[model samples]
Target chain A: MSTVKQAGGRPRESRVDHALAEAVRALLSEHGYASLTVDAVAARAGVSKAAIYRRYATKEEMTFAVLVHDLREEPPADTGSLRGDLTALAARIGDQIGRSAADVMTGLLADVRADAALGARFAATYLAVERSVIATLLDRAVTRGELPERPDSPVVHALLLGPLFTWPIVLGEDPDRIPKLAPVVARIVADALIAGALPPAAQDGLSGGS
Target chain B: MSTVKQAGGRPRESRVDHALAEAVRALLSEHGYASLTVDAVAARAGVSKAAIYRRYATKEEMTFAVLVHDLREEPPADTGSLRGDLTALAARIGDQIGRSAADVMTGLLADVRADAALGARFAATYLAVERSVIATLLDRAVTRGELPERPDSPVVHALLLGPLFTWPIVLGEDPDRIPKLAPVVARIVADALIAGALPPAAQDGLSGGS
Candidate 1:
């Protein structure tokens, strides 16, 4: 709230942002979201609480910013085919979202259901980004007539992420193994869409034959 | 442990089991998995701490027993086709795994990554059951020639569960809405497999075509 603008705002603000990001990542990895407090973050970053509060109103907002920022992949370059686009996008997500980011999210997911405010933030940040990535790919496919209609965005997004996201946990494999499977997972999900695997309602009356 | 059997063997065991179940459900529902304590459970259930220790070796064992016990659905009646069998099984699971089960597991999941013992327990119980159900259905399909081969059980299980399990959380829909989608979800997953959506690795070299 006070004046720190004497040194020129942009560079100083970036410096604080960098410090806060480092602190949030360290604290979240070490103690997880349950113990992340504004005070701890402030102390860890060596910044006054005012700086944190100025940037984020709550711990959820702070954690969300750092974790989700890592996932803010630029729109994948168009690859002229639905399968290619999905493969590129899924690979980018798999490559960018590291083990710590996944851990932070898994931790945050537990808290989301209990707190409506946190759930709202998660949907707006994480879910919104996933939907945008999905839209970019699906819109291109629809334009190319690869799909009769776009499937439900949420369902389609889950198809892309659910199996690949849980691959390590479910199989007890190393998380590092996911990179090899990224394109394969993308291919399967894309082929599923091409094969008419949308649930009946998701088909949205597109195919009434059933 | 000392002399509870004075009343009778079977009835006393049942009573203790019932009380422990109730206590676990209440504690998990109220405080999630992170805060569950043997002391709290024993106090709440009015059983000795030794009584709990006699039953389960650790908190993970206790939580896994109570939570996974709820999911011990009887093997679904064989419905005579892959789709029918999957639908029946999925519907049963949807009906049994209520919001609280989902919530408790979601909370436990964050910790599972951080704790290897808990991860082992989760896989032995929750994932084991899921694999068994998928195996039952897929084995039947393979026997009946509905499938060229059995797909990878873990990947197939994820296809069945990953979307439906996250439906409420991702859509922000009421958990009560899952039952309606259960059959539909089953159909889609079954169709996906039939249509050869398995990633090339999961296809197990059944099809030589690229």
Candidate 2:
């Protein structure tokens, strides 16, 4: 977690941090979030408990860091068209689905539901970052007149992601089904946009006391 | 879990069972799935550990049984039009959301993700039941010619429930919002239906090796 060690050419301090993060990811893949313990992380990483505690205040914080690291690795997709961008996003999301990510996500869902502060942090950090990416994509489409000027970004975001998110959790639905289904989902979303399902912005002067 | 005691007019066995189930629900609400133990449930229920063991084979089994009980209490939604039926279904789903149900569901997600057998059981017993309810509603719509002869029921079902399910899990979204958002979601779904977003059936001779 420190840059000084790497600058000094020692690399040991940074190695411990990387080891701890990798350990968290490995354990999450194997055991999921419920059974993960800090002590076990230290043992698996070959680091001391003090080292783990020095870096992260809580398990949730550590997990969030790992997720952020993973998120940064995903290149931003800009395909020039709303349909292409959304479909790319879907494929990116679909690529993220596997045993490990799904397991971590299932565990994260519980953590998010149980703790409000943690949930807010997740929303701000992970969810918001992704949403902004989508917003930017949609904004470009708006400039091209492919979308409304003030489309309901949040609703569109939900529509785009809801099925992908729900598929694994809901029984009998395949998480892998997203790739095949992304085009259809994107088409439906584009249709919603054209039909003006997006909420009217306040600046549109549509407000009333009704 | 046994009905024999009621037949004898003693009611002791049935009381123990009810107490155990209530204890499970309470503990689930209080501590979620990971922290709940059979011994703790026995202590909370004022029943013997052996009695608890006799009823359920494992913690997953017990939790699944509680979910099934809750599911049974939800009456099926049926209205004349597809829109009306979907809206009613959304309302019923919205009404079922609360602290306890959310807590239990959060716990179940962890369990289902961790254990394949338990996840499948949940899918089979709980998810399948709800799907059947949606299927029945959709079937009536099809009969009335409101829907095509061969519709993609799963996609329609996914569209109907995805947003509702995503809310309260993702930040800043409300489960209760589904009631208000139902019509909008149903409208998009209806549009998809007419636009033929649904995959055509194989019986229509569309299958090919291409």
Candidate 3:
């Protein structure tokens, strides 16, 4: 008896994945997070729902895939100086925010709130990638003796992203403000790095000394 | 025919308002942002939907009211020194996180992501209150000469909350880790304030001399 061999290799079309990702990105930009739907993505991509499902198990997974694909893998070029490296990194981040990334972020945040599991997954995948990139940059600075060899690198990383996230999203500042703020932030980071690297006793006297 | 006016100037019921606010907090804790609903809030509050509508007009308003009611009105008590004041503030924030405040924050962030207008409202009501409180503490530090006046006061305020918001929520670290990190963060703020307050040439040489 000849058994029908089920074709288990290379089962899906790569085009479908690309289309779905694009569709999800478009929908995220247009509708923000609250109104995004799997059905809408499938329709926008002009692909069968079955095809989309074969790739992604849920809307959350699909949305996450798009973000993963979009997030840059490495920090911008080093430029041999901390200020230049940070300036480039800040500018790239600012560009992303101007591209309606705020809408995508809002959607992802909403998903995390709705489902605890999704929140964990989102953090593990998207946030971890961005943070690791920043950490690597700071590590480079430490190796070059540009920053102190303290345990506060993580705190500095948070300071960089926190204002970027909070000002527009929470404080309702115009996106145009980021360009001006980027240099100011770079200066603050420079000062903090310089001061943090100093010896404890000597550092204490500087602030209080006439 | 004589028309009679409602008792207590438009017949507002304090009991209904309190119930609605409590219901909102409960929903935030239990269901987070995506699952919370105005209908559910009314049901849980044991009040007519019309009664809730009369007070809030929308779920966003109800959520705002709950956050306003729950937010800490002032920074922790003065400890006579900047470090002591900061330690007390960090501990108070830690307490809030240990309670239901983290859940409320998760829900608020989710709501902001799903709805731009709702996010704006959340920022104005909830985050603004926190910022103002931190600003007050930093202002005290400046007065005590522990912090320099050169760095914008808002920047100093951001330095305090930036780590708290970025690490656990954005980076998804354990909330319990905040207090452990607070002292290092305080040091950075202190250093930044000192460096910024110095004259330009002195500021440039402060980090290099050490």
Candidate 4:
């Protein structure tokens, strides 16, 4: 998406991009992901099929972009403490859960299981934002002497988000339960960090050979 | 499925069930979940299609049963200490992961997102077994003065099995990494327990009203 046009003296591309994104959300809200189509998006946005194709090659990519577009704007507020940052970020994640997005995530995660390319895109597009934010917070925590060092990222991700993601799905809670449960999970994570329960330096080549 | 037959003079149903389970595993490995069919399973097992139909109502149900069939035989070992028990349980979860099962779980979980019936069955059939074992461990830990009280179960489940499930998928690690990474996660959960990082009661109606 580009800058504001006319009053701000920006390009026409801005309006088209906004319409495209708005269309995606409206259609997603109206009909679930399964029924969403590029033609419908083009018709709804009044943006040409050619323009939509120019931006995203497939319906899936278009949907992914729109779904996570909010991450570009809103980040957890800098609350000036490690616990506050962690809790804020966790709460940010919790707030993201709504009926429609949750439905979409379930289907998306299933596809991600076997598709490495899509998984990488998801990492780069969606997860990387959180990763960068979390890294900033953790590094700041180290600077402030809250932690001796940043704990491992995988475990950090797990503690920060694992419960929020798995709680309702695995435990039979209402899908809406994510918003309520997030704070409790965040507290558990903050406590884990305080107790030195996190390991330093996340490893990719996990485990020693037996 | 019934008891062992012939040699022990138990019911004949046991052999049919055994053959059916074996066939399911073999087919799942051979063709993957998408291609796995009741017709193929019956043929492979030399069990009649009628027998298979009598047992499972659909392809999804049959697959779910075969995939989780191992849980019926193996509960996580009781290692006599809270940390040990948590680690042991986590390790058991890790060991269950494999290529075929992971593929199937991805598909199944996608369906579980929208279908409450499947979700409840999953909790009762699979998660409930782990739940029972974990509850026993937490209660014993209380008796031994290891915890103030049993920690909130949703958070406990997240710490125990979250990273193992999410690490490979979310972080782009090999699906095979689960077996190795499981121990490390187990250690984290145990340390969280020692540090009192877990909460005492998991609420379904979570969060203070905003």
Candidate number with greatest TM-score? 4
Better of 1 and 4 by lDDT: 1
lDDT of 1 by residue, B1-210 (tens): 211113344777778878888888898878877788999999999999998887776776677667554335345778888899989877765554445554565666667765677677667765676778778788898889888888767666656665566665433445565666567667776777777666433544322222
Q: Give the alpha carbon lDDT tens digit for every residue of B84-105 in model 2.
A: 7777776665554423355456
**Docking model 3 quality class:** incorrect
TM-score of chain A of each: 0.79, 0.74, 0.72, 0.79
Enumerate the candidates' DockQ scores in order.
0.30, 0.34, 0.20, 0.44
Better of 1 and 3 by TM-score: 1
Which 10 residues in a row give candidate 2 chain A its minimum summed lDDT?
A: A201-210
- What lDDT does candidate 2 reach at residue A195? 72
Candidate 1 docking: what grade? acceptable
TM-score of each: 0.78, 0.74, 0.69, 0.81
lDDT of 4 by residue, A147-206 (tens): 888776555775576666666544555556576566666766666676676556643344
lDDT of 4 by residue, B111-140 (tens): 665566776666665677667677787887
DockQ class, candidate 2: acceptable
Q: Looking at candidate 2, what is the lDDT of residue B92? A: 60
- Provide the lDDT at A122 for model 2: 62
Candidate 1 ranges beyond 4 A from true positions: A1-12, A28-36, A44-46, A70-74, A96-98, A101-103, A169-172, A199-210, B1-11, B27-35, B68-74, B101-103, B170-172, B199-210
lDDT tens readout by residue for model 2, A42-109: 99999988877765656766776555433333435667777777777766655554233555676767
Tens-digit per-residue lDDT, A45-142, candidate 1: 99999888877766766776676542344568889999999898777656644354444656666677657777776677656777787877888888
Poorly placed runs, candidate 2 (over 4 Å): A1-22, A29-32, A37-58, A61-77, A99-101, A201-210, B1-78, B98-103, B201-210
lDDT of 2 at A132: 73
Better of 2 and 4 by TM-score: 4
